[model samples]
Target: MPGIGPLLGAEFLAATSGDMSLFGSADRLATYAGPAPTPHDSGRVSGNLHRPTRYHRGLQRVFYMSAMSSIHFCPESRRFYQRKRSEGKRHTQAVLALARRRVNVLWALLRDGRRFEPAQPATGTA
Candidate 1:
């Protein structure tokens, strides 16, 4: 919820109605949001990733925007984006990857009935 404003939060709720169980898994949720690239294998071209024609574009927009917003305000998320950029990923590609990753984290948080908490940096080895 770090980047999810009232509009994004309401959109997410309207899209899922807080029913995390209905999707069965985070991967499924990502696909529903149109980010989980589907395999487009043909001949020698194998494991090619492409978006499905039938997907909720609005929901996808919500996640994409949330990820973009987080990049500015969340340190961990900004670090993750920077890592992706350093690894040669383009802006859209990096943001979509982050959004997909967020799907898994949000799923687990909801499943565990927990709120989002910023990770504390390690002070030293115990």
Candidate 2:
């Protein structure tokens, strides 16, 4: 809710219909939303992951757009994205990774009926 504004919030609500039960887990929701790449297994050749053909395009767009916006509006999200970028991930790849991560956070928030809060930075003692 903090990073997501009215339009994106409405899109998310419409896409999910405000129903978290439909997805038993955040991974399921991410898969449905088209962010989690599906694995393809065929005999000896395995470990091939690709975007699912059968997925909610609108839902995917909602997550991508919201993740992009969150980079500026949410410090934690921005840091995550930057970390991904620093790891040699391209722009789109980083955004997609962030979007996938958001799916987990959003799922937990919806399940527990809690609001979004920026994660506090960890403090290290010398």
Best by lDDT: 1
What is residue 9's positional error in candidate 1, in angstroms?
A: 0.8
Q: lDDT per prediction? A: 0.89, 0.86
Number of the top-ranking candidate, with TM-score as the measure: 1
Report the Cα lDDT for residue 114, model 2. Answer: 92
Q: Compared with the true structure, what per-residue lDDT tens digits does model 1 show for residues 1-126? A: 678889998899899887888899998898888956679899999989886788888889988999999999999999999999999999999999889888888888888989999999889978
TM-scores for all candidates: the values are: 0.87, 0.82
Residues 25-87, model 2: lDDT tens digits: 998898888856768889998998887688999989988998999898888888899999999
Stretches > 4 Å off in candidate 1: 39-41, 44-50, 124-126
Q: Model 1 — TM-score against the truth?
A: 0.87
